[model samples]
Target: MKAVLFKVGLVLCVLLSACSNSVDDSIDPETADDDLEGPISRPTSGYGVDGVYKVAELSFPNTEYPGTQVTIFYPQGTTSGRPTIFYAHPYGGEDKEYNRGLFEFIAKKGYVVVFVPYPTTDISIDHRYLTLWTGFTKAATDYPNIIDTKKVGFMGHSFGGGASIGLAYKAFTEKGWGQDGRLLFTMAPWYSYQISPAQLLNFPSNTKMVVQVYDEDKFNDHRLAIDIFKNIGIANAEKDFYYLKSSTVANYRYGTDHNLPNSRSAYDAYDYYGVYRILDALMDYSFNGNEAGKNIALGNGSTAQVTMPGYKNELMAPLEVTDNPSPKYTQSKYLFPCSSQENPRIANCN
Candidate 1:
């Protein structure tokens, strides 16, 4: 017993020494503070919904651009073949660091989020988006145990959002992928500004589509997304449309610019509400088989009702979500899921 104890003690001492040495080598002793905690940082706000967890980062290689990169926030502990979301960062955005807060929120909710970095200088050679799609495909193929290729959703903010629409159209129409699709929720995207009237009219409706617009957006026409939604709703195929009345209401903003990373503090509320709303729609549209897209209302004097594609006469109320019990922390108290129906517990990465 004495010999065993001594051996165990000796091994523990060696391990501790190794760890200490590693820390010494990696960190500058002069800069290191005795009070400094390690790599972990707590969230500034409370956890939102039940399935929502704090955000996390994921790194993968960019096949198109050898040294370039792509990142994702995956829900924790999700079993094999889970649904995935390809999230495109806003225009002129840097690494995943800028969107980490929002991505983390989505990731913790049992959905894998892929963030595409837009090359600021040259929009033509969007190798960043290519890399994102490629990396996502590779991850799904390589780790079928971790991803479900069948159920995939694409999303983006601003320019990223616009690009996501183009990408989705190409994927479904040109590439012949995701035939039996559900929905694409474009958060403050500019479909009307970027795509022409003909192009917008041409988009197919086999997949459900929802466009979120803030009334106060500065760039482009204010009601661009809603305008397109109306045209689509009136066009050939079946579609549903929803419009948010006030972007500045409870922890939400419509005036956010194309670059979210540079000014996260200025629009933290927008980040929270914008991301949560999109994710909520994607989750329901993809998994629940719910056709509640028509329930979104553009709050003004205009009288618009939520109606499914084929049966235009049948109107329904927008999705109703209830708030969860308050979180134990102070910062997170104001945070709430965009959809009251979202349960934060089940949404955790598990």
Candidate 2:
């Protein structure tokens, strides 16, 4: 009887082991593959490609704005019909070398990047806006064969951020340039002029705007980004407000400050990993028409959703025509020299 009991126990153990194997084999192949693959990497807190294409830098005298210079970053071996981006430098930052990392990264991504340096002496807000618009127009005209004018995008930091908005307004209302689709990305945008809520509504419906805010920014707080985002009237357009959270990464000590967007001042965790990821995804989605990029921008999944632990985001859903009416403006005003009286250099007045 003892021998029979031992044999029965051994058989039961074997059957149990076989049942476990059968259950493992029954898993769906696709589900098993996904389990092995793991979650998609998020761009919110990581760096992107490091110079995929060789870059060629060229400088040209701006005929539109005398004494001003326009620098072009052309990717070598790039064929004709590439997307273009107009980058406006922040006030007191006329030297492109200060932000070389950002510019080169964008160029390596296959977009023709034009950097416009305005006169640091002249603190005229309107003049800066005009210079940016003129520089972009000139770049597009000069490199018509290389730049796809229809796929133009604008980017800027600080005062240049305000100028980007102004340029977008001109491009949409007066110039009718970015009707096909335009991208406007502003980093820590300063309030140069008193932009009314109605004026903000004038942005083109097809325009995609991304406003970035540094959480620890003392000079220009996140409120400025919120205000700008609130006033945007493009109900049918894609818009997002991103807040770069302060980093606690080991040895990465720089908080998300006002100057964090500039390569000269940005920390590696924020610049390469954080800001670069956002810019890369934006360009991919807006210019390259990559669906993955759009998902990232919208915080759907992948890099977009995987930000730092403390980072937060807000998105503006596309508005329906029946729910949100089209924007109309009777008079377009160009406010001049909107710099603060205290500093006279910074564009922020309030």
Q: TM-scores of all models?
A: 0.57, 0.70
Best candidate, TM-score: 2
Error of 1 at 66 (Å): 4.7
| Model 2 C-alpha lDDT per residue in residues 54-80, reported as the tens digit of each score | 677777787656876799887765557
After superposing candidate 1 on the true structure, give the runs of residues whose Cα lies further than 4 Å from its correct spot: 1-57, 123-132, 174-181, 190-204, 223-263, 267-270, 273-275, 290-350
Give the C-alpha lDDT of model 1.
0.45
Output the worst ten-in-a-row residue range by lDDT, candidate 1: 320-329
